[model samples]
Target: MTLLPDPAEARAARLACRQGAPRPTAGMAPGFTQCNMISLPKDWAWDFLLYAQRNPKPCPVLDVTDPGSHRTALAPKADLRTDIPLYRIWRDGVLAEETPDATAAWAEHPDLVTFLIGCSFTFETPLQQAGIEVRHIAQGCNVPMFLTDRDCRPAGRLHGKMVVSMRPIPAGRVAEAAMISGRTPAVHGAPVHIGAPEALGIADLSRPDFGDPVQIRPGEVPVFWACGVTPQAALMASKPPFAITHAPGYMFITDVPDTHWQV
Candidate 1:
């Protein structure tokens, strides 16, 4: 197994990425569980929380910030307003800007509530330990995500079809991949569906809704799992007056370990 990078080191690396430091090798921090962040006004908190609950496969709830508070308690003494390497601010369902920090924008909205969603990083450690290679990490490209035909149960004003991330696994190791990831429910536990992409309403594997596509080797099967991007899609569909989320691939590393999420 590769030695786990120090959390402080990982945090500094992310900070450097944010500050335009030369891009470090991708996937250097092997074991730490990374998270997807969402910040919204207090009025929408209850609805978004319920949305995540209704769609556990995609929106795995981890931690949340106190209304109007910038600090996140679940992670390593981090600030929700700035710890993330990059942020996306949405206005009326449209992306307004992608920036390194949201402190300035968030300052204007004193009643914002932040949510940290579980990410696939929590499960990738075990996958790699089992000798399954994560292609995107090896290729230094963002994990490919797609919008699926699967619809999540509606909650208040939050409702939308599920979005998923794809990983190609060798035919011999598909079951092992599924079993290893199925154990951790907090970070989108298990594959929601596998094998065919078209079965999930994905028309073309090469053109993903988000992120770059990886070459699926001839014998490898494309596997699909629920993705954290579901919330961003929901937020877009709902068209909330305002919202914020972590840029894809840039997640918030919490203080908790993968074992902390084990069933």
Candidate 2:
């Protein structure tokens, strides 16, 4: 049996997994649910929220922060402004800077609204428990994500192609993997497509739009799922005045349980 790490350790492990460098934690609180975060000005909040609701597969809504409030009531005791290890600050849809803290950024624009999206990490534990191997974890690299030809149902001022993360599953176990992951719809649900990368317009499996690609050993078929990165793609295409997202893999741990997210 795979022993799950304690929440505190998991959070630390996640922090260590950040792109580079270690930062100080103001208060080390354990056992919280770490979510994927996005912050945008009040003007863009409505469109983004509607976009998330419309495209539930790629953008699963966990919680939305009140305008100008840095505290996340959904993950009470969790500070939306500073709990995450890293953040990407976007300017007119382009990634302008990355910082370890969003407190200063938030201070700059007090009218910003924050969003907490469900992340696949919530389902990973159960997937592993079911004997499915997550390639990125094994390779110690970020999961390979692709910008697919698939377009999300657009909301006002928000429109872009879907982004997906891929993992290779042994041919025989693909069905089981799908069933296990399908149970958690809030965090991306089941496989969007299975086998044959070309169907999704992915030309070379070795090259990915984001993150490092992993090996697909013989007998393993590639599996793809809608990813949280989809919204970032939308942000780019929409060219919002300002937006912020958790840097890839740097999620915000919340107090909720994975099982609670079952559809």
Candidate 3:
């Protein structure tokens, strides 16, 4: 059985990550939801929100903060500026650098607004409970993510290709995996594609655009899910002046349980 930590303990682990400890959050806090955070200047909030609205599967929103505020309803006591394990700093749509925490970045852009996009990792717990083998977890690596050829509906200045994360499942259990994850729309509910990376214009399963790749065994097929990283791809395409996002696979732990978003 997988060990699941309570929310507070999970937050503490994040705090350690903030202080320079490195860890991927894929299988942590098993019953709690995880989020992908995007922090940007208030000037860019509305367009991004509209973008998220236009593409709900990959960009399902968990929470949004008021202008210049770091606090969110997702985890009242957790500091948005410091809780996520890693953050990607983007300048003019280019990756400027990666840091474990966002304190300095927040200081440079104090007027930033934060959006917490739901993550598919939040649903993996149930998949595991149902006896599905989460391949990346079993392989002990970050879930592999790819950028697709698909275009999202344009919303102001935010528009880009959809991004997806892949996991290998036994051929026979693919439907069961889909059904288990389908219940939580808030966290990217179900598999978008299965068995064909080329169908999505993804050329190679081993060379993912983000996160680490895992092996696909003889009886397993690669399954893809819409990813919150889709917004980061949008950020890259739109060339936002300044932005911050949780590095892929390193998510923000929320106070709410994963089951709260079940449909």
Candidate 2 Cα lDDT to native: 0.78
lDDT of 2 at 5: 38
Task: Show pairs that collide, candidate 1.
Answer: none
lDDT of 1 by residue, 104-220 (tens): 889879999988999987788788878899998888888888999988999999888898989999999999999899999889988988888889999999999987898899889
- Per-residue CA lDDT of candidate 3, range 14-84, in tens? 66767767679988767888999998899999999999999999999889998889899988888888888
Q: Rank the candidates by lDDT, best first.
A: 3, 1, 2
Q: Write the number of the candidate with greater lDDT, choosing between 1 and 3.
A: 3
TM-score of each: 0.93, 0.89, 0.96
The reply for model 2, stretches above 4 Å from the true place, is: 1-34
Residue 43 alpha-carbon offset, candidate 1, angstroms = 0.5
Could you give candidate 2's per-residue lDDT for residues 1-263 as a string of tens digits? Answer: 32433555644544453434633211122223446788999999999999999999989998888899877755565566666777889999999998877777788787998888877666777777677887877776777889999999999999999988888999999998888889989888898999988989889989989778899999999999888888899988999988888876667766565677776
Best candidate per TM-score, number? Answer: 3
Global Cα RMSD, each model: 2.0, 3.8, 1.8
Clashing pairs in 2: 32-254, 33-253, 33-254, 33-255, 34-252, 34-253, 34-254, 35-252
